[model samples]
Target: MDLDHEPATRAHEARLWRDDGWTAKVIKNGDDDGWAVEMTQEGEDEPALVGPWTMGRDKKNPKPLDSAAFITLVKTASEVLRRHEQQRHALLHKNVTIDSGSDRLRIDLDIIPDEYEPYAELSAHNGFGEELARVRVQPGFKLSRESAADWVANNFARPS
Candidate 1:
């Protein structure tokens, strides 16, 4: 870790620190008139995690950023990023397959959750690497083993 970019060690003040591509900053909390800290990964526009800061012994002000506290924050922030990536992976790539007569059909459900509108796609591919059909579906579309078989039986028609 670069010392200049990293949060200063054994210090007492609301400051910013960079370590292993993540940045941690302690700032004043606008909501509660207290201190809050934000942790953001490098190149990301928004902070991955934000939480209330600890108060000093006097209880009137936030505790100065220290090595132990910084370490804890880094661990917590890392977890937040990891969970976010896992969720995105689950949403973007989902697959299932069913045997439709002689050839097996692979069903894929891809979802893109946008702010304005979320959409999903239901696609089918045959065992010989042939695309049978593709259709747009609602984000909340229910998909299961039975559903995939039914869709195939219906000649890959869009499910109602």
Candidate 2:
């Protein structure tokens, strides 16, 4: 495919391939005397998926990469990246709902995974979704029912 006047490269070598914005390469397994395959997306520095590779007919050589295998590897690598993003999202955003007198409060903790200045935002909202309080807390702050309750009981002050 041609885009921006640049044609996308498409290769199907025996142990390497580059197509559809992904590249698959066969490498020696570090843990054992076997072969492994790594799939990396274009322009990325790291491989999205890496796993064992099948042996060839001679039983001593790694199986040559083919169109079908490359396609499967791309799909698998895509899924791994998708799941990793989902897990990161879950870890960075958390919330808990607790009862405070007759009113229900929802406490949210959003972690900012900055490289140098990591921190988190702790906020509380009422049942009607009105903001009650917000403060900056440590990035590793634990958010749970008890913690949320304690924050509310402490008048929404920043937790230490």
Best-matching candidate per lDDT = 2
Residue-level lDDT tens digits of model 1 in 1-160:
3445644243244577666666778888998868898987766779989999887788877877766777888899889889989988986878898888888889988887877999888999989878889988888887788888887788878888
Q: Judge candidate 2 against the unseen true structure and give its global Cα lDDT, from 0 to 1.
A: 0.93
RMSD of each: 5.6, 3.4
Give the distance in Å from residue 72's predicted Cα in candidate 1 to where it truly belongs: 2.2
Question: What's the lDDT for candidate 1?
Answer: 0.81
Q: lDDT per residue, candidate 2, 1-160, as tens digits?
A: 2345453488889999999889999999989989999998877879999999998999889999999999999999999999999999999999999999999999999999999999999999999999999999999899999999999999998999
Question: TM-score of predicted model 2?
Answer: 0.80
Q: Rate the local accuracy (lDDT) of all candidates.
A: 0.81, 0.93
Q: Which stretches of model 2 miss by more than 4 angstroms?
A: 1-8, 30-33
Total backbone clashes of model 2? 0
